[model samples]
Target: MAEFKPVKLSSPGHSDDGIAVEVLPYGLTIHKLLVQTDGRIHDIVIGPENPTDHVAQKYTNSIVGRYVNRVPVGTHSFERNGVRGDITALPNESPLVSLHGGPKGFDAVPWTLLTEKDALQLFSKAEAARIRAQPESSFAVFRLESPSGDQGYPGSLIVEVLVALISPDHQQKISENTPQNEVDNRVGSLALVYRAKLREANAVTPVNLTQHWGFNLEASLNKGPETLSVKHHTLTIQADKIAELDSDSLFTGRHVPLTPAHTHQAKPIGKDFPEKGYDDYYLFKDDLQSAVPTRIPLSSFNDDSDFVQDLLRSSDNPERGLRGPPAIELASERSGLKLLFDTNQRGTMFYSNALAKSSAGARKKIHGGSGVSGSGDAYDPHTAVFLELHHPLAAFLHTNEKAGEDTLLTSEELYHNYVRVDITSKQSPA
Candidate 1:
């Protein structure tokens, strides 16, 4: 390994009326919460110097996990050395059900930071593994140990989330000296990384850990439903059949369409328009073909509006062909931490930022006088998408973790799956 440079942490930047923020060298900044003079508690996120190049792609500034977005009860069992332990309901839910490993998730507590070259070690000792995440690297990890009578929940769970800023240099061929015609594998791109470990102190149990990111590609304050397109995107799975939804169109398994279901394969956001949004998941069929590779213009996604067509033409990358099918590599930067699932937890959630409208986005709330937005510019259907790796919430019927004990999920690594994830101007299959 190359010698790592020490991370540079700075003091908080002063704010006139709000909280202050601190910057980190590895493209990270921390926005500590502040109590306003008006008796209001404001939320702040740490970010990198270049929010777009370094921060936005990092998903690190905040630690976002707490039972990490809805979990089903009864879906998980508790055991200690083969002995059955009692389980409880999860807190924070309206109806009460076990969500993110029973409260005290990594994001709920503070973390100790030990920085080294190219890596930051954060440790948390909460009752259960707890952590939070922003759109960039620089996450926190909390830990805890069970003290007594395996009360409502079973065995003790120990989880450690190792977070880092994944800013590896892109080995693309773009150089000052290379002939304009020759290609160099040295393109500069900025990104972040998050990876963690979970173990049961006594027995074997199922564990699931995932990140939550809200993306808006158009830079619209209301996360307008920008255009969208999925090209040459093929989903392959081992299952012959998968779960379907009751009323909604959402699927409950790592759904991928069968080879014959290519009818809806490569399409445009303009094709679907405003009538509906994509908050559903499709099951992957077993014999699916591998994804094709392409860069730059992912796919031409625009409405009949001449303005929309003109916008894409002006910024689209030449390497990324605007014509033909968009190649689908489905690649994400944080290697080795790719999600693998067991049959017990066999679904993936595909959620569009359905709730992030204009004023509802990251904009600061204006006081008094009439503010902007509410003009139908909030969360549109085309801004961005989320491919969550988890099980259906319906599985766990009842859950509670007030026991202040450990409730961790532990499992083995499965297959190696890679997905192409883009944060900038390049095409889909770069």
Candidate 2:
């Protein structure tokens, strides 16, 4: 196998308020992410310190698709003009599953640097469009044109992804003169917005895209102990059901009630961490929205505990035209870092890095050294967690006939999906 070397690119004046980011043309990967905390800077996402290490590492801070996640291994069928055709999984990485857009997906390819003005823009030759970004909000957009039969899938597709980092300052502002009963809501937070669009003038295809940034809120790749992991982080997913998966980790088209062990109601991740470490999809409840209202009066709560409880509760009726609360929240009390994840998609895939240790071991043989240097033991199990927003895998399955109209995207209609990540300093009760 030939070595894949990634080209590094930088955007001028992108840093703000002690937050810094670095992007790569390969996969438009987020190479370095640093946030200032306690007067010191720390790297939050696990990524290759050196550009060459990217090829051997997991999709570390990179965008993966044609399709995100797994599509069952075999010949799957789709419909076109009342005719049936089959698209088979490449089976490049796994023998039984087609993971992350086959063996040579977007993450493995190098993109062209189109423009570096307000935001960085990258173009993939295979996929006609460009991926753009801006420094102020740390926003990046991916625009592409996928020709029919590009990746074993049927029909042509035009995909666009908009990713932005929304700071707490942009959220609903709280007033100093507000009543004492109201929550004093001042927390440093950032939201990552992933908006995707599919436009095709003549054909329809399966579309599922997600941002795969594995987060370790407490530890930093540039600082802290080598063995530091995300095992201590607390998790809560606003989901009551889960999609069932077979041994190979493909969705079995079944939605089962969440088990007690899988319950994430402000609970420690390690408390009931699954043996496989969360490679499952949590189907969020329908009544929630993405953002917390700027302020809520104390009349609704009786005490501090009630305040926390109320804050965690999903809005019964979100405002007439507003995004809802996060589908999941991951926090690290040790480092005072908290992450709120909100998405308009139907489900969120939570993956604990349980296989990292083994994967890293295998990567060492192909790559001269470990995937990343200066980070000791950073590839351990449960070192980080990935929350991906998208339709359930079942939506893409085609057994004997085409999927229902709701699951597939058409040329006449536009498909838009949004995912928001709110990074905040956990506030303490008064």
Candidate 3:
């Protein structure tokens, strides 16, 4: 792992106007993540570092580039008014088009950490992008400059990453019993915000953007069980449609029924997840809304003790070997998480770790306070399911009655795309 610089995370009312996040001088970005009951850090993001390198390779906690996620067989061609661009860097090799901005993806480039003492952040510009890779004939991406036509993409884009440490008060609360703790109405700032913005490069109209990051709520270094829960979690998705996964749980052409339309509705992630994890896009039903309220069933267990074991176990039926399907026991455990969304962007992809399974000689371990343990896919199936987001109502945004709609990306569209996660364990600002 590359040596990461750290950022000092503090409470609210802590900084000046232009500063979205107060950073340190190291190359690393410090994110202030709040911990709850038992004082454990269940809130997972990248950069904190993982025991294995597979995660780093998977772009864990890193800001990745130009176009995120799978773009349909790597061929997203467009003819703006008559100009053609067959973005061939996509779809991973064997492509008629481009994928992820070609091999020199944004993740591969090393970003400079803007720092000032114990506060530092990761920031990248459009000008820096033009230095490394070549562009396409019709479209190009010029870092810090107007968009180039060499990469078959449009307009120049700039992206930044910041992390902060927050909420040090929860140290005692998390250590105490039951998570039904009281909230302090003090004026202390206890959260971190990752602010992202996008404006057209050379005034090139609009663009579609999103963040693709995989998450597993019950992750601990000593604990890596496939145990997960969606039941009683009361998931309030903002969308109307569901994108089903193929046999492998990757995005297929099928759209499944999106359950839990209005209120609280959710099943164990594994209950419906196939042998592999779930990897599909879900359509949002609510637009211009804030907060996707989801409650963890951890404290609402039928039998809290029994539920804990199930949540910690890698598999219930080990005899079936590695291919056995493991349903989640959301009957127990509490993530103490109240995910609140704060973005004009739309869509969220809820994926499950379908590609996870035990390694050659891995063992399942457990912790006293942390609960369960399993080295990702060590004992149970531990794959990653990413929640990806994109432009609000992207599919039908430009469609018209007489003429077909065009989906042309914004130059600044390449700037920032994401689903900002807020650990709202306390009744704080989301």
Scored by lDDT, the top model is 2
Which run of 10 residues does model 1 get worst, by summed lDDT?
331-340
User: Mind sharing the TM-score for model 1?
Assistant: 0.45
**Candidate 1 per-residue C-alpha lDDT over 1-430 given as tens digits, one digit per residue, 9 for 90 to 100:** 0111223211111132222223232222232222121222322221122223222223333333323345444334554235443345454444444444454444333344433322222122221122223222323322333322222344343333332211112334366776533331211111122223223333333334444433222221121112212211222223333344433332242323433332233233234333454454333332332232111111231122121111111112322322212222221111100111111123344445454444432332311112223333233333344544433333322232212112233222111111222212122121
lDDT of 3 by residue, 1-430 (tens): 3323333333331121001221222222222133333333443322223223322343433333454444444334554433444544444433432333445455444444432332211123322222112211111111222144424444444434433222222222333454443432111111112222234333332234343444444443333232332322334344566655443333444445665332223444444444434555665554333332111122232221121111111222221212221111111134434443333344555554344344422222221122122333342333334555554222312233113223344322223322333333333221
TM-score of each: 0.45, 0.73, 0.54
Quality of model 3 by C-alpha lDDT: 0.33
lDDT of 2 by residue, 1-430 (tens): 1123333322221123334556666776776666654444556776555666777775877877777788877787665444344567778657888888788777777654333442321112211121222243444444555667766766666554544443333323458786533422223223333322234355556666666777876655233333256777788888888888888778777778999888888898888667778788887775763343211222332222121122222222222113555577777766666666656566788888777763442222111225445445336677777877766674657342233212455444444455544445423221
Better of 1 and 3 by lDDT: 3
RMSD of each: 15.9, 10.4, 15.2
Q: Model 3, which residues run further than 4 Å from truth?
A: 1-38, 46-56, 72-76, 79-86, 91-101, 115-152, 161-209, 221-234, 244-266, 286-332, 357-385, 392-419, 426-430
